[model samples]
Target: MKAAVLRAVGAPLTVEEVDLSGPGPNEVLIRVVASGVCHSDLHVMEGVLPYPLPTVLGHEAAGVVEDVGPGVSALRRGAHVVVAVVPSCGRCRLCLRGRPNLCTAIRGRPGVMADGTRRLRLPGGEEVNHFTMISSFAQFAVVHEAAAVPVREDIPLERACLLGCGLLTGWGAAVNRARVAPGSSCVVLGCGGVGLGIVQGCAVRQAEPIVAVDLWPQRLEVAARLGATHTLLAGQEDVPALVRQLTGGGADYVFDAVGSPQTAALALSCLGRGGTAVLVGVGQRDASLSVPITATVLNERAVLGCDYGSAWPQRDIALLADMYAAGRLKLDELVDRTYPLEGVNEALADLKEGRALRPVILPWGDS
Candidate 1:
């Protein structure tokens, strides 16, 4: 198999021929069909998040099952599946509570697979770390069966890949975490792939005056096409003030999809009394945001942290697939472009430069 290896921090990923071991017990070997170039992946590449070197760094992906190891009864060879970044151990307290997104068993270490073994190796036999359990940047991935959410074959793998992370996180943040109610005012901070999904999710819930914020006019325009009733340029306007004025006070629900402390603070500032601020973006591990204690207490404002949109991959992915198939969700519209695996760096550059939205990577050439 060929995989892109990140050997050092702040370095371009090198495409090289790598060897992949067969799945271990309870694992599934998947042939990567498509993966999305996500901001989280860029964070890893830019050293915003710490991961060991020489790692395969992609998590948002969909693939076809090539084989299944022992004890993997839920999936079989030839099944179409989307890989979830976080794996759920059914016995965990969080998983048992129906919050698999916060499964304690898989919250910390992200560089290795379930069994604590590296499945990928360089041609010269050096082990390469796995990123987020599913290294879909490669041509093949060996992941725990729990990470593979089987999807309908009718859904295209390219679009279905978005369900693994960006789309799920954004949409779930609104629908599941914040529970944006109908007739409520909603504001999303950022207009990238995840932000756009939040906008669409608010739309689906019939939220009024959906406001999309971003530094780029193009992204704001795309957000409007998807669901945003209004758009605001980040630098040109006082975002929180404008949102407050537009919503008559402040938005009932504000989502920060940019993941920076600044955006997180802005999201909270854009919330009305009793409104909820949902943080969906992943910033530096040690990043901190300061909040006004008096306002939070007096105004009854709430701040919520969301991981992968607080979604259950098995259920949410299927629901998203159905919604896409039925035309209620706009998966195709979120995809700005596609790239071959060799162009992975270029795709990442585009994403970082805000030149593309949800660029799909075809590990195998687009057929």
Candidate 2:
């Protein structure tokens, strides 16, 4: 199979033929139909997040099952599925508590399967690391069965790919994590793919005065089309003051979708008394944010960190698929562009330059 492998940090990914092993017990082999080029992948390429070298770096994907290993009764061949970055072991404490997004069994582990074995290898016999245990950048992936959530077949795999990570995280952050109530004023920091999804989720919740913030005008325009009631240019305006003025004393909820210390701080600054600040982006490990303890205590503000929108893949993906199928959710509009496997680097470049939103990688090459 062909895959984009990152052999060095701060370098472009190399697309080349690689070897994949068959599914192990409780694993599924998928013919990856579409994969989304996410900011997380770019972070890995730019060394913002460190990982093992020679690894395939893609986590958002939708595909069809080709084979399933022993003990995998939940899925079968021909089943359409989305690959989840976090694999929830059902027996784990978090999974049992219905918080599978923070599965303790796989958090911060190396990019390997449950048995701690590499399923990908180079022609020279060196093992290629897996990213998030899915490695959706490749033509095929052998992922844990729990990481693959079966979805309705009617939804196109290309658009469904967004549900794997960006859409799920953003949508779930607003709907589940923040629980933005109707008529509540909500502000979403960053107007990328995830930010737009957050806007849409707020729209679905009937949140009033949805504010979208970004440095790019093009993205702000798209956010308006999606659901932003107001758009703010990041560096050009007094964002916190404007938000507080517009919402009659800060927004009820603010989400930092960009995942930087600066954006997180800004999100916190835009919240009203008793309001919650949700951190939705994943920043570098070494990056830290300074919060005002006195203000937080006085204002009774809460700062919350969200992982994958605190979504349970099996339940949330199916619900999202239903919404998309019924036209209640906007999946088609979220896709800004599509690229083939060989064009993965170009897709990443477009995303890094803020020229595209949710570029899907068609592993089968526009077929």
Candidate 3:
């Protein structure tokens, strides 16, 4: 099989013919169909988030099951599935507590399988690590059965792939983590792909006066089309004051999808009394947040940290698929462009330049 190889930090990925091993116990082999270029992948490629080198870089993907290993009874060959980055062990403390998103099954091992072994290798027999359980950048991926959530066959893999990462993170933060009440005021910071999903999620909950703030006017425009009642340009507007004005005092929920210290602070500033600030983006590796204790105490404001939208992959991804099937979710609009496997680098470039919202890569397609 051919896979994209990241030899070192800050290196350009090269497509190389590699050897992929069959699935082991509790694992499954999936033929890659559609994968997305995520900011996290860029972070890993740029050395912001440290990981093993000579690895395949991709986590968000959807594909068809080619085969399944022992202990996997829930899935079989020909089943369409979406790959999840947070594959839970199901028996861990977090998983048992209904917080599978925070499962500690692979704390110290982000690059390999649970048993500390890789399933990919080069022609010369050198090991190539997997990124986030399933490296969907390749022609095929071997992942734990739990990581592969079965989706409806009608929804295209290209659209369903977004549920694995960006969209899920933003949408889940609203519906899962914050649980914004209907008619409540909400403000979303950083109108990227995730922020756009947050806006849509707020809309789904019927939250009023959805305020979206961003540096890009184009994204703000997209947010308006999705569900934002108000949009503010970051550098040109007094965002917090405008949010306060739009929401009648402050928003009930403020989501920081940009994940910077600055944006996180802005999220806190946009909240009203008893409001919560949800941190959704992973900005910097060494980023530390400082909050005003006196103000928070006086206003009774709260801050919440979210990972993967606080999602249970099996439940939430399936719900998203159903929503899309019912024409209630905005999956098709999220796709800004598509690329073949060979154009993965160009796709990454587009992501960095903000040229596309969600670029899907077809591993088997030709340009």
User: What's the lDDT for all of these models?
Assistant: 0.90, 0.90, 0.90
119-214: candidate 2 lDDT, tens digit per residue: 999999999998978898889999988889999999899999998899989999999899889999999999887898899999999999999999
Model 3 lDDT tens row, 1-367: 9899999899889999999997988899999999988998889888988988889998899999999998899998999999988888779888898889999775328778866789999999999988987888989999888889999999899989999999999999999999999999999998877998899899999999899998888888889999999999999999989988988899899999988989998898889998999999986878978999998999999999999999999999999999999989998877889998888989998888778888888999832
User: What TM-score would you give candidate 2 relative to the actual structure?
Assistant: 0.98
Q: What is candidate 1's lDDT per residue for 162-247, written digit by digit as tens?
A: 99999999999999998888999999999888999899899999999999999999999899999999999998999989998999
Whole-model alpha-carbon lDDT for candidate 2: 0.90
TM-score against native, each model: 0.98, 0.98, 0.97
Candidate 3 residues lying further than 4 Å off, grouped into runs, are 106-108
State how far residue 10 of model 3 sits from its true place (Å).
1.6
Backbone clashes in model 1, listed as residue pairs: none
For model 2 the local lDDT of residue 209 reads 96
Clashes of 3: 0
Worst 10 residues of 1 by lDDT: 104-113
